[model samples]
Target: MDNNLTDRSFWKAFWESRIGLIFNIKRDYIFGDMLGKIKAKKGYQTAIELGGFPGYYTIYLKKYENMDTTLFDYFVHQGLVNELLEVNGLKETDIDIIEADLFSYQPETQYDMVLSFGLIEHFKDTKAIIATHLPFLKDNGTLFITLPNFKSINGWVQRKFDLENYNKHYIESMNPALLASYCKELGLKDVESYYHGKFSMWLENKGTQSALAKAFVKSLWFTGKVFTKIFPFESKALSPYIVLKATK
Candidate 1:
């Protein structure tokens, strides 16, 4: 993900659409996983979502739990926010919405948790992105990030059998160890990272794909789903997503 390409407008459209290869939903498993992490730590009163578009994750956090939430993203996608509010039968009083480029915006107050999913991987400087958010989190706050694990077995399967599904925006695939090192260098404490999501998820969330791609995902959908049910365990090194969290 090149910086030049990650302009506000592109992301605005990306949130509204599922036309491109990279426009993937933050799948249910990943959201649930994040919620579990937040609950485990037990201090989720105030939270902000960086690059939160369509604002589903923020909505989920607010709806299921008690939290003061803010969603930051480009202004062009404000309509999507409104739509989400209406669809969820929520009101503006529920959460604050800020429309601005993620890098330029500054928070007036720090939060208990700062979250971003499929965000840092798009940039060349992952550390810089994380660093920018540090000032916005309260002391002992949690920083949570999730990225597509392109180094995993599911990644290999996509590249081999579904090239269109593998896009260039994934400039790099990061592991838990790599994420831990970054957090350490940045002075973040209690760092933890690992894999999430089974192949079955990839099969079900093939959004707006071409006929050929749809057929391909469908062909193996049953097998993948069954495999997960039988195994009932996610492989740390082979899952589809890498989840990272640390405290500041």
Candidate 2:
């Protein structure tokens, strides 16, 4: 939360995507659990991912979901998808890389699933988002999107950085509620969101009592000791990131 000492050089980890992708999308398949909730229909067999920076989970989707994946990005070469797929030890034919502007791109065919992480907040025109993927989503397809919430640790960082530029800071921190309504209006069947990553949000969500708050919070220190043991998924809520899964 405190950017006072976080030099720009230190922020390189956040800017350099490939490294972050490994830690963000672990081999455990967090998205796999979310996909399990989405049952494919009779003829549904494909999925598309938007803003696929570095293609971290492309291999996972092919291996686990067993569906053809089309990757759409504003800036990707003909072999970006193939390069990542091969880096992950996956075949070249398993994924399709499409380089197009998401705001107006059209898909050749429909898909059973769509993945968009941390992009909705960047764009205000929700219709543009729907137009790009709605036709591509087969009946009962899943749209799994992740974005930062005001309750995330990133918020704390932004808030600190905000001292330099107030407007940019507030924009970086957004409410998850807006996303909920966006999903509902888009004809998404089930809307569920979780607060994940970083520790400040957890502390803020689960309020404290000054009298015994120090003692209780000391016991609840956002550490792996009790977090992994008591509530792993719920612990995600205390963190700084937001992950949502819904169906169309």
lDDT of each: 0.70, 0.56
lDDT of 2 by residue, 1-248 (tens): 12222233422343343332333343566556555446344344677877765555455677666767777766654454555566566777777777666655667777777877655555545434544566677777777776556444435434443333222223432455665676777787777766655354223222223546445445545454456456555343356556766677
Q: In model 2, where is the ten-residue run with the lowest total lDDT?
A: 1-10
lDDT of 1 by residue, 1-248 (tens): 24533666556455556443222233363466557567666756888888777676777677666578888865436655666666666776798888776676777889888888877776767677778778888998888888877776566656765564455345454667877788899999999888777654363135546788777666666667777888766675446777888989
In candidate 2, residue 12 scores what lDDT? 36
Which 10-residue window of candidate 1 scores lowest in summed lDDT?
Answer: 18-27
Q: Give the Å error, residue 248, model 2.
A: 2.3
List RMSD in Å for every model shown.
Answer: 4.1, 8.5
Candidate 1, residue 57: Cα displacement in angstroms equals 1.6
Candidate 2 accuracy as TM-score: 0.66
> In model 2, which residue pairs have backbone atoms overlapping below 3 Å?
152-240, 153-240, 195-236, 195-237, 196-236, 197-239, 197-240, 202-238
What's the residue-level lDDT of 217 in candidate 2? 45
**TM-scores of all candidate predictions against the true structure:** 0.82, 0.66
